[model samples]
Target: MCRWLAYSGTPILLEELLYKPEHSLIDQSMHARLGVGTTNGDGFGVGWYTPDGPAEPTLFRGTGPAWGDDNLRELAHSVRSGLFLAHIRASTGTPVQQTNCHPFRHGRWLWLHNGRIRGFPTLKRTLMLAVDPELFPEIGGSTDSELMFYLALTFGLERDPVGAVERMVGWVEEVGHRYGIDHAMQMTVATSDGQRLWSFRYSSERNSRSLYCSTAVETLRTMYPENPVLQRVTEGTRIVVSEPLGGLVGAWQPIAESSYELVTPGMDVVGRFNPQSAQAGLPVPATVGANGG
Candidate 1:
């Protein structure tokens, strides 16, 4: 329902990805090629870590379309970061307010999501109750995406990113099923804690939203030796997106369904995700032959 991109590599101006590509995130704001919605114009936001500035990332958000935001264009031209996240929203029954924009921040961490909880209105209260009381006050928006972030935090995202998210999804699905919902989850999410980036793709129905990560610079350089753009980035440079930024063949790889990828300094990781682990301490799934997502 929305579009987003996460970049980790040699520092570069935000425009390189937000505007320069033929199918950039800003372009996706108006002409998304792969999202469930053709245009993600409800709102937008960008968060970036300044290596020398603060432990927390800098965030700029707006309640209007990303493509029409002059402030966004200005910042995109001037702000440079090695690690950043950008998102353009397509509201799924949520109010269009600044606080509801993506790349939501909490201290050093930033989180965003694409896709909806199939029956969010019905599932909200139960899921909200699961959030830690201490962290609950920090929630400034009413979107399921933001709630998912808090739920992950409550489940220990600060210590274990993958496990925390799995628990979050499992808890959501568990609650949804108890309410007689058949498919309880659908999402492709990205979250970063200034140092590393973690991304996930999964849906209760098994056919989730789109998610992709950039091919390693070395691999791409070897394949397209004459491409000047490949020369600008370092070996550690990587990008994760709802869809490819450009039509460059072999420059992007699809993350499989029911999986996740973690991008760190040295070796990156890809792993199979299992929500069954989440059901351990939670209520058992009820069998009324119903579902949610």
Candidate 2:
């Protein structure tokens, strides 16, 4: 169990989302209303694309609660980015270390997750052996979240992100079933390649972790014209978080179960996510519901 936020849009200081909101990510670290745990204090990490850096993002991570990290506070106040991701971890039986912190990076891509691969310790070796050998050496942590990233990479993330992630989940579920586990996964994952932001919500049992995307900026502006914050960004700006950053009423929309939201430079897209399970011999579209919007 963990909490994370992904941002894409107008370049602004990191604090605009990380700290300034009423129930910001910092607040979630201590009072997460949706996460399984009230406090996600094992570790935290932030990744962002600088306007003038290499295609890769700059990452600052620590093995401490995001709420108490002084360096995170200073960095959040100082850095500005058009796209970024931040995460606070509540370990699902993993060691607490900086490397295990989220917003994990590989080249220009960054990934983070908020749910565990149920019984990861039992399935770890089987799943790990399936990772692409060339990509295997890049593995740096013992967390299922990081391994999930590599699994997606092994399945082709850079070219087709959605497909890669779908395959990754399918594979995990395939292995879990081999061990007699009924429900193998629960995930609300967000990833970015310094351009578009992609997020997904799915679980084998049809009940996944919580995830929400901001309502379209134009609509929010129409709803709250008096809000100064809404006036600063273009319509392309959007945020995907494990939970709402603030109680803005209409500011957040829950991502449908077994589906994904993609925020690009052009139009944003939401679509059904059917995992291409090897066990099923094809991609299977699990049942999806409104989630009581």
Candidate 3:
């Protein structure tokens, strides 16, 4: 229901990615081509990491739309980072407030998701009841995306992100079914710990939202030898987005349904994802079918 991007690699001005591209995040706020919403103008946020600073990433968020926010344009040119996440929101049954913005933070971690849980209103109490009490108070907004983040944390995201996410989704579907709802999940989530980035695309119905990552930097450079932008970046550079920033033929690669990807210092990794198989990774105490006993 929104559009977003996660960047990891060479330190460059945020504007280089958020504003300069033909179909940049800023432009997408006004005219998103591939996302569920054509205009993700409800609100926006940007989170970036600085090597010399704290373990946690710094955040800049506003309740206003990105396209109308002059401050966003100014900050884009001023901040330079090797890793950052930007999101343009199109509210999915949540209030348009600053607290509901993306790139939600929890200590050193940063998470932002694009999609909604079907029938969340009915599933809210059950889902919220599943989160750890300590983690529950930290939830500042009333959005399903934020709740999913906390659910993952409660399920041990810091130690095993993929597994935690799987449990989170599995739990969502589990609750949705108990409430007589089908197709409970739809998400393309990206998260980072200032060191590595993880992204997932999955849904209850198997037709998840659109997501794409850049083709290997070297591969793109070889394919577009004439492109100067492709030439200057280091090999470790990677860009994951809701849609291609431009129409470069070889630049973007689609992520398959029921899959996840990780962008680390070495080569990026992609793997199949199944929420049903995700239970083992979660703590025994938090299994979806486990009783209050």
Candidate 4:
């Protein structure tokens, strides 16, 4: 129900990915081809790391369509970073308030999600109770996506990101089954701790949301031998997004279902997801219609 992009590598002007591409994130906010909806106008947010600040990221978010936000346009043109996360929201049932927008932050970590819990309200209480009390106060929104972040943090996300997120998804599915809801979770999440970037694509039913990663810098260099921009980036640069930003067909590859990917300073690693045993014990929340109203 949303679109997002995570980038890591040589620092480049934000507009190169957010606005310059043919199918840029801004363009997707108005014409998303792969999202559940065609438009994700509810809100938008961006989180990026800079050399001058605390290792923690700086965030800019708004409760309006990204395409109409002049501030976002200006900032995207001027700011640059080696790592960044950007999201355009299509609220499932939450209010379109600024706090509810994504690229949510807590200390040095930043997170964003592109899917919803099938039955959030019914599960909210139980899920909220499960978050580590210390991290609970850092949650600033009512979206199930944001709640999911805190749950991962509760399970030690800061130390073992892949494991914690898998645990969170496992708990969500377990709760769904307890309520007789067949498929209660769908998500493609991206998180960064100002260094490595972690991303996942999963759903209980096996047909997860769309997630893609850019070609390896070496591969891109070989494919576009004459493109200077392609050559300017370092071999370690990588990008993960809900959809490809440009028409460079060979530049993106879809992430497999039920898998997680890790982008570090030197390499990109991908692996299968395994749920935690404890997660299977949580109760599923009751279901409700799509009246997100």
Error of 3 at 9 (Å): 0.6
Residue-by-residue lDDT tens digits, candidate 3, 253-289: 9999999999998778899987853355554344344
Instruction: Give per-residue lDDT, candidate 3, residue 225.
Output: 88
Candidate 4: segments with Cα more than 4 A from true spot: 279-293
In model 3, what is the error at residue 191, expressed in angstroms? 0.6
Off by over 4 Å in 1: 277-293
> How does model 2 fare in lDDT?
0.89
Residue range with the least summed lDDT across 10 consecutive positions in model 2: 284-293
Tens digit of per-residue lDDT, candidate 4, span 63-161: 999999999999999998989999999999899999999999988999999888998877676667677667778888899989998888877788888
For candidate 1, which ten residues in a row score worst on lDDT?
Answer: 284-293
Predicted candidate 2 versus true structure: per-residue lDDT over 71-185, tens digit per residue: 8999999999999999999998999998899989999999999999998888887787767778899999999999999988888889989989989998888777778877888
The TM-score of candidate 1 is: 0.95
Candidates by TM-score, descending order: 3, 1, 2, 4
Q: What is the lDDT of residue 256 in candidate 1?
A: 98
Order the candidates by lDDT, highest first: 1, 3, 2, 4
Residue 291 of model 2 has an lDDT of 22
Q: Which pairs of residues clash in candidate 3, taking residues 3 or more apart in a chain or in different chains? A: none
Of the candidates shown, which would achieve the greatest lDDT relative to the real structure?
A: 1
* Per-residue alpha-carbon lDDT of candidate 1 for residues 1-293, written as tens digits (9 for 90 to 100): 99999999899999999999999999999998887779999999999998898878999999999999999999999999999999999999999999999988999999999998988898887778777778889999999999999988878889989988999898888878788887889999999999899999999999999999999999999999999989988898999999998889999999999999999987799999887545444332343223432
List TM-scores for all candidates, in order: 0.95, 0.94, 0.95, 0.93
